[model samples]
Target: MPEQSKRLIQLLENEGPMSIKRASAKLQVSERSIRNYMRQANAKSTQILTDHSKIWVQERKPASLDFSRALPQNYRERSSYIIKKKIIEKEEVDLFDLSETLYVSYSTLKNDIAKMNQEFHAFQVHFRLKKDKLVIFGEERQIRKLISHVLAQETATHIIDMETLLNNYDKNLVHIIQQEIEQIVVHPALSKNDLAKMNLILHLVIISTRCQENGGCANDALALVFRTEKEKQWFGQLIDHLQTRLAITYAKEDLEQIQVLLAGNLNFRASEPSFEMDQKNIRFTSQILDLLEKRFHVDLNREEVKELFLRHLHNLNIRAQTGGFIKNPMKESIRQISPTIYEMAIVMAVEYKKYFQVLLPEDEIAFFAIHISSWIDQSNALNQKLKTLLVCPAYLNFQSDLLQTLSTRFADELYIPHVASSEQSGMDDGYDLVVSTIPLSTVSSQKVISLSPIWTPYTQQALSEKILKIKERKKGEMIRNHFFEYFQEPFFSVVRKTSKEALLHQMCARFNEKEIVASDFEKSVLEREKACSTAFGGFAIPHPLVSSARETKVSVALCPEGVLWNNDQKVYAVFLLAINEVDKRVFLNVYEPLVSLLSDEEFMTRLSAQTDFHAFSSLLIHKIK
Candidate 1:
């Protein structure tokens, strides 16, 4: 076998899978050359790979180690990978010898080892002595995980490379593994991107392959307590397939972990026979929908949302029972784009803790956010869209990008009727609102709202609010002036970090400085929150239990990071009410409509995207109206 062929095989065994483009780049060859090498690996080195040997056999296989290029530049760059491979191979190394190889002093190598010892120990791996030479020990399974994590960190792409995980860490079965997994899962609702499914499969391969190699027996660490009769039958069939196909006997724990991965990954499409839903899952799903309806006033009990949640909850509960995890590729995207949904996910975390007695990880929370975001999009689709006109500068700008973005985002909410350039300034187009980049004094038969060029979160909020206001005013219902009077924009702020009490104190201090509330306002608010959670759909409606403020005012804060509201809920948005005795009715009138709109899944999605105070206030008034 050629050196490239051996390298290709080794890479596949250790990493998992890679695209032809990536493999060519990693190997410093053309994609065509890589393919030829892959073919050679199968034909010539078949017996060598069967042994699962990590050593380079020069005669049997001419693919000897090319040390100079393979070894990374420095200890800082190569230490982890080198150490991991050495440990996996059970190769002992003396400090003095490693110092010579790495071109560093013995003391420096000692210090690096000491630092690494502390770090690897966290993952249940230990660097200790074996036959008077430093080597790695501890749980072999965890050691493999630590190695996988390190290699994954090296790649910049989202793809998880499968390194011969199924081939005893030696052969390529990327296509076969993917196909087998799809057949096994057979869930229709698998993520549209399929990255989530791949992630699930990658984790399973890592754990299962390592466990099997170690002759790992059944461990109850992550086994499910409850399973439908059908799930049990299905799980058994799947395990048998994996064992027979991969040529490894899976222990009870190995089978259980695979089940946990699949269960928590609710990417399953609906079943023909209707899944035997868990009783606990049904209760939890009902509670979640009930909470959404009570808090957001949106009925997500539709066939799709209900079915999706049940599928997700099936795994969520199992994860809740076993503390298993499923990586969400869209975790960061959901956090950045739909913070409100992310907070709702945190709320699920809190709620899950209440019933299941275990907290779901953020990735799991993001899985929940995926469902909520989808529901919001689908719900919004059924609503009436607003008509608007875009007014850009005389010169061509990035207006088309802005239009496409806004249209895509607020698909159901906004419809751009015409694109009017400021130089021409035609106002008779009869649009619901004129969103002008430049200030336009006159726009007959339409509302004119000047926006910034970048279409920042602030501008998006402003545009959304303008459309809502037009609709609200047509009802002869004045929700704007009262809101503008009570909710001070200067008092409003966007917080990245802060605790619940600390945030409350800060908001109360602002009100005190402005002479809007009494000294005990923050205390009373905390007490109220303790009495009952103020958070609903990621927004907390915390206020004094009794009316005792100087006036009826709302002090608001948006924390995208989400503050822990109590032991259960985390809130991203805060609405602090300070209502006086005379304005008691004002609280009921404003609070009811205010919380209802803010709690609305669609509205929260919109609000979380806004980046400015004007945009924030504009949306508030529109929703209130």
Candidate 2:
């Protein structure tokens, strides 16, 4: 079966039924092609069923996929196959044999090897062909790290477990390792999530397989040290269990690397400081907090928050030093949930790279973001609560009951300081929300919610929805007030078609000519774009990796013909933001709402069709209102 058909089946199984038109749009195929894919997929197993104009999965019966016979079809898959053969499977392959198996030309196979070498540069590993036979050479530690990365990329769309493990590893070996991990005792502060535990089992299997095949990973540079006796005891027991169960012995360096991996994966949250933390960790934590304050205007220097941060930093430092980092499975979800917190985490990562000269992987960055988000949540809970006014008419003294329900439900979200009758509601217009039993004739400008005197599930749900809308409206209003200030007429353009680099260059040149941005602004923006595309929901938000603009300004480009932002994605609109240091907070204030507004695909499609800035901006402001 074609790869697209398998992907279509996976999509339907994961994301429920979708109309043919919607599926075609999402898969970047024609309606006819979608139907063809459905037919091909259904012919294999009859799992895909179509009802009217929609397709869905009836059941996901496992298919006996013979990976050995199925040759890799793309550069990514071919590279993964080659790496797995050399590293995990410990097999050497002749170039001619591989070319014949992959159905590629000899020269093409050599070119692929060159590309793999280039990609492997960062991991300090490389592939070399000795007399047309492929062999991999690198530090054992680096080799394992590369294997972890390759495994992650291969199984990105699926869960990591026995079923997935069987695709690449020996089933009996995997089960043996899993059984041992299940028998071992977990630490108190370690994560007990089944997924994390499964990941540990997978890595241990990788380590044992490699060591058993070749030899122990012995490096004199790594010192085996444990901070506390609990950690030491834990490490000793784990190694002893693995050695006894597997009939193998591990080197000190392998033990050290294992300890680092444990620290990276299992260290979820900090408890009381087991021993006095190091001064280097203390200094790094203080610097990060100060940097967060300076860049985002966020002060996370409270004693409790600082202490937790310091403890996490201790583990982070260990990973940096030992060159063993765990991959985060929830990295994408965390990034999508709170982009603002993730952005703050990126700032910390940049500082980490500069201070430690070790680049933290995206997984490690996501883990650090967990800590920062918790601290921010704590600070927001204590300091920021919506001031609410409850207005219920005097009817059997039921106003008290209604207020009590609200206070209990939204204790952390709302602060109800005043209770007034409908007639007395016009006296105060200062609260963020006005909840009333009776309709208000006046106070037209206030955010008013009229509900039943008796609080029911319907009323509670309505109030919850209203509170969310109120928050978004206030956030939208903040950006709307200064919308014109950031988006100026001179910075607006209507382009029939353009490339990302061309558009960025034109805008950055204009800004540079007007002395609005530094000369290196375009370079920074391009670097950031290459690292991660800013395109989202048919629009792109391109910004610099670092803020050093003379003045903060937003440039808008309406590409009615659609400019390609990334592979398989064309952006109809581009929002290029050049932010100054002093105006960083302003950027944060508007970034979320701006993304939210542009994320409306239908609205953006219509708005981008407008030829003039006046029409586009007007439609945008009206929508925000």
Candidate 3:
């Protein structure tokens, strides 16, 4: 059945008895297409029932179509289906016949193949058509890599898994492989997370399927030096089980490739190595810690933390080498909740790129951020407590009870050093935050929280959120203080919006005229921009890759019409930074917090909308408070 027809049937089954017009509108299809969908759906099965105006579904019958095995619906899916069959399965396909199966015309199918070939060019894989037969052209390693990429994306959401590939592999065989993977015992250090486990399972499944179909032809040149005897034993046992169940003898090259795969992805060596560390990773981890220490003014070179970061970097390097991409579902949350740590991870990624010439993915960066966040949490545990003032404004007994409740609830996070009556609230400005039972006119709303005399789960949740905001605001205030020192009135100006490069050149020239930066500062800034964009969170901070300035200064350019920083980002605020050698650390202190604070879309918009420097500075300082 056509994908549209199947979708229409499913929609009717879900929503139940929707008018034809409404169904057409919901699906974003024309009424005529809706009618055609009903006709096509009923042609296969009498599940869809339609009248003049409305469409509904009858009782679902024994399934005539196995929707579980998804038909190639869109271009991506269609390309994947073709690649899997013709390349991975090594099956010759007639274009006309395959096009009919996919419900796309032969010409459209040809166009898809062309586009797919273009997309796969970087992977060194291609599809070629001669006469009517479609064939794949690529080395075994490239072909396997492409296959891994496709399958990984297909199963990224886990909606499509081993069972979905039943069209190529036997149902019984898929089940056996899944069961074998489930039964396999891995080392304690190996990841058992859902995403990591799925990657291993899918890798094994693909190996088995390719070996079963093409036998020894699935061999590759990839190799790995097993760091432990346990990894070798595990690989041997896994291969033995698969060979016995699937009735195939693996080749020597295939065995070696599997060893590399296991060591890089499935073995404990990938994530948490108990054995001797790789010297390169040890150096990289040390350098990263040193950078963090120098940039953020904190030492994290303790042996325990060093070993942990070393293992993580070693595993990350292995993933880069082996084309192993582990999905991190918490990447966005991690970025938001601990953006300073995320920025630190980006620095690590930049250093890694310098060493290996490979840029890590966002997920990997996020994983590194988690490690750094934990380290920061451990190192700062003693000093991270929030200094708070409690204002109960009740009887002595009730005030003591309130303090006890707060201490019991937030002992680790909050340090209630002072207690003030409602009348004394205006007199104290020393506390980081004020937790009061009554609203106060003196305290900034950002620094004050009003709660009921009685506490509940709702109160706890609200207070926790307020505390997080206070911490974020405190960070912003620190950055703002360092920032305003370098932000001069003479350096601030309003400019007509222009191209990113043009605006950057203009600003660099202005800085050069002021003799604040080196002669080649513009070149260095453009080089840095080329390496990695500085435009983020609705603002751009362009600076030299290596700082060499006569004086540390930040030139502010307000673009009311917006400057096009890249294809995706347009910015109204540009902070061109020129940092002297002595001020490099100071620049970094301002950079991370500024990025985090500007990540708030509302705040960025409000700050960028200011036409004058005074207005922008005032609004920023106000927001910080």
Selected candidate, larger lDDT, 1 vs 2? 2
Writing each residue's lDDT as its tens digit, candidate 2 over 1-625 gives 8899988876765444555666787789998998999888878877677654246665421111123435579876788777765554334577887887778888988877876765555456878889999988787766755654554332212334566566556677777777665666454322334544654565577667656665554445444555445556766778877777666777554565576555433331122233466887677777888766554444452543564456556657776889867555556654654444565576677677767777778878876766675555434333345777777865774775676566546755676656786556354476788888876777554478888988789998998988888778776887787787678889999987678889989988878887777688899999999998898969999999987665678999999989988877899998899876545654686888778878888898898899988998889888884
Q: lDDT values of the candidates? A: 0.58, 0.67, 0.65
TM-score of 1: 0.25
Model 1 stretches astray by more than 4 angstroms: 1-476
**Highest-scoring model, TM-score:** 2
- Better by TM-score, candidate 3 or 1: 3
Q: Write the per-residue lDDT of candidate 1 for residues 1-625, one digit (tens) a residue.
A: 8888878766654332334555677688997897677667768644323212232222222121223433446544555545643643234466665666656677776666665654444355777655446867666556644544443332212224343234333244345556566776554324342534655566556555555556656545444542344345656676667666766666654555566555434322122214466788778878876665444333342443564457557656665666557555546544544433554455566567677777556667766765655555433323234567777754543565455555445544565545666635457454666777777766753477777777578877877787777754433243454566567776788887788878888889999998677687888888887888877868887888888665567887888778887686777788888876544543455566676687787788678667778998777665654
Which lDDT value does model 2 have at 277? 69
Better of 1 and 3 by lDDT: 3
TM-score of each: 0.25, 0.37, 0.31
Name the 10 consecutive residues with the lowest summed lDDT in model 1: 55-64
Clashes of each: 18, 0, 0
Residue 147 alpha-carbon offset, candidate 1, angstroms: 78
Candidate 2: minimum summed lDDT over ten consecutive residues — where?
60-69
Task: Give the Cα RMSD of candidate 2.
Answer: 25.5
